[model samples]
Target: MDMEILKVDRLSFRYPEEDRATLDELSFTVKEGEFVVLCGPSGGGKTTLLRHLKRELAPVGTMDGSILYRGLPLAELAPETAAAEIGMVFQNPEAQIVMDTVWHELAFSMENLGLPPAVMRSRLAEICGLFGLEPLLYKPVHELSGGQKQLLNLASVLLLQPRVLLLDEPTSQLDPVAAREFIQLLHRLNEELSMTVIISEHRLEEVFPLADQVLLLSRGALQAAGGPREIVGRLGAGQAPAQLAYLPAASRLFLGLAPQAAAPPPGASPLTVREGKAWLRGLPAAGAGPAAAPHSAATAQPGAAARAGEAALLRCRELTFRYAKDGAEVLKKLTLSLYPGELLAIMGGNGAGKSTLLQLMAGLAKPQRGKVELGRDIHTGYLAQNPLLYFSQDTVAAELAQMAEYAGLSGEEAQREIARLLDIFQLQAVIDNHPHDISGGQQQQTALAMVLLLKPDILLLDEPTKGLDPEAKERFASTLQLLREQGVSIVLVTHDVEFAAEYASRCALLFDGAITAEGSPGDFFGSNYFYTTAVNRMVREWLPQVLTVKEAIQQWPDSGSRS
Candidate 1:
């Protein structure tokens, strides 16, 4: 039998002033070399639990539990041993970085560990090559993209060759491509180095299939814990619970198609696109006839009311921009138009200028060449990737009220609006807490609430779904749809292909500082083999128009109502 590398026994914790515990009676064990995925809805205590595993980062809270590393109390471990053996990467990479350049950052860890110069040099060389950070060795940390910074953080942590790694949504800020690469790297480390990995992630499509064990938590309690397939079986049939929306797309689709009375065979639930495709092919006469396209949200053409030969709400014409005078152009002569009520999703790899384009559209940055034109009396609200930057107030309630007041709503109007937002974002419990103390998803929701208070004509959002759980993302999409109904145009820069595919009215591809392609979701995703949604990848050969689980279910003749 494998040895237990870490164990948690009846662990429970409540933050200061919180009404209830954040983590309640959680117990589990992670064996050596196991790839464990810690997943749950937003604010479900995944981060709280991970912090308890590392001595330095554990928060001050009421506790009734014990955590052990190799049969010893984790808290009793020496400071140096805890620091060297337990490596953690936070959600925001920028928060972990302190050095000016990539080389310095990687070197700083080894220096603190008191590793000899020869050993440090050898380790740095190996880590730099592993993360492909060699080219960026001398590059300034701030000049790097979000994905690059995240990779640097991981590389730096791995330089210590920790026996156990704790990652709290490390890929939340990364683009799709970068996120996949990061997960793959983790898998490699776990397999080759026998590194114990305990990762908390909202995006489960990639990690789910690779996880040796999956733990589901909700409302500060463990709902289930088992292998990936076993956990899916426990979810029963049809749609997963709201808190369990992190289920992989393949698993979700399989659950939808399976008969209500049937339980998935032991270790038979499809968790990856490949297994899903094989299972679909095994079905007798699957998609025998042309699958009828379901009633689509895209039926009414995007921006029909706002762009029926009407002038564009915002236009970027031949825009070129660079952060420094001698730096390479971020956006090169890029021209695009945003129609009113258009939820335009700009997708691209890291450093593809998607965020820069949003900054130009929001009028936060001026182009080195050409111009950005706005429709008469149009207002814009821009939400940056780091939601914490958008807040100046100490508390969540104060932040929302301040924004409401700034928007000129007074008396009962401001009160009603703030109340509505608190309900909509499901932030009632955290209203009195400091904005910085909340979970990342909560912070993003709070920031979005503040932006909506502005009531702008156009919304510029950069990776707005970064830290949100699947259910929270659904709520966010509904909010966007409501805004669209009110004729608000939105420019969304995101790496979430699934969200863009399901909710975006139009999707645009940015590459090499220009718009490479732009079209409706169907056309945009159907054409891309590798970059499309998991549902699209699973059913594309038979149902090319299907880009979401709901759409895929519509095409399935026997797919009954999704509960």
Candidate 2:
């Protein structure tokens, strides 16, 4: 049996100003070489708990707990020994990076450890090769795409050869392909190097299958801890807490389609897309649902008929954009139209210029050719990818008030709107806290609330789902649906394929600086392989139209139990 790497015993903590504890008597143990996944709803103390494990970054707060690393108290360990033995990668790639160039960032940590030049060079070469960072070794960190930046951050952390790696939503900003690749790298490290990993994330679709152990938390308390299959069984039996909604698409489909009493016997829950497909094939058909059809690009215009008579709220015709006079074009001859009340999702790889297109549409940046046209008297609001760009006030409440004033609302109207937003975001507890002091997800919610205050007829959001937990994402989707009902058009540029497939009325793929594909969610995601949602990938052979867990449950036989 593997030895215990870290042990937490009856841990509880609270910030200085808060009355209630942020982390309550949490007890858990992680074995060496284990891939542990820690997850829960937003603001549930995941970040706080991770921080406490790393002595240097632990938050200053009232605490009563003991964290032991390899049988030694983490607090009593020497600073250099702790730093070299344990490594942490933050949620925001930009937050943990310190140097200007990729090579410098990798060297910074080793230099502080006073390692010899030969040893540093040897370790750097090994890590760069392992992470495929050799080509980008000399590149300035700012010029790298989100995926590259995140990869570089991970490579930097691994250079020290830490025994245990802790990552806090490390792929929150990466594209789907990149996120999958990152997760695979984590798996490789755990299996080959025997490097223990503790990751806290909301994107459970990919990581759930790779986890050796799963830890679920809620409001700073450990709700469940077990094998991934065991947790899925709990979710199926309705025995798991609500925070366990982070279940992968496969497990979700199995639980939903399987009968209440048929929770799939012990640890037999389907955990992967392939396993899900096999399980689905073995199921008895209820009514012979629609036959799966081969998807083709010809289905691109399926949504055009729905918007036939309505005028586009915003249109970009043959738009071209580039950041510099001699640089390559970011968006070339891109033409798109957004109908009123429609939510259009634009997805692509890390550097495919999705954010640039949103900026051009929002009039924050100009196109070198063609033009962007908006309906007469139309108002537009844009939420930047970086939430910090929109915040000016110290506290979230003050920021919301400032936004309300800017929207020309005052007194009772402003108060009512502010109160509603606070409740919807579940941000009332942190209303008086500084936006920067809160968690990344909370900052994202605060930014979104501020954007809504402007009351624009057209809203442009860039990666609006980043850093959000499952429950928060559901709330955001519902809010988006409500906004659409009120005739507010939205353009979302995101790498979150699942969110786009389920919530966006239409989806478009941007590739090689141009729109390569566009269609309704069913037509677009259903036709995709790697770029589609987990459910679509799982059931594409039997039900090509399914893009979400709910859709799969509805289409497949839900009552029968296969013996």
After superposing candidate 1 on the true structure, give the runs of residues whose Cα lies further than 4 Å from its correct spot.
237-240, 260-262, 291-308, 557-563
Which candidate number maximizes lDDT? Answer: 2
Worst 10 residues of 1 by lDDT: 295-304
lDDT of candidate 1 at residue 530, scale 0 to 100: 68
How much lDDT does candidate 1 score? Answer: 0.86
In candidate 2, what are the lDDT values of residues 409-501, reduced to their tens digit? 977999999998898889999998888778889999999999898898999999889999888998999989989999899999999998998
lDDT of each: 0.86, 0.87
Q: Once superposed on the true structure, which residue ranges of model 2 sit more than 4 Å away at CA?
A: 239-241, 260-264, 286-289, 301-310, 557-563
Predicted candidate 1 versus true structure: per-residue lDDT over 173-284, tens digit per residue: 7877788888999999999999999999998899999999999988889988999888887775333567437789888877767664257777777889999989877765
**TM-scores for every candidate against the unseen true structure:** 0.95, 0.95
Task: State the displacement of the C-alpha of residue 476, model 1, in Å, after optimal TM-score superposition.
Answer: 0.8
Clash counts for the predictions, in order: 0, 0
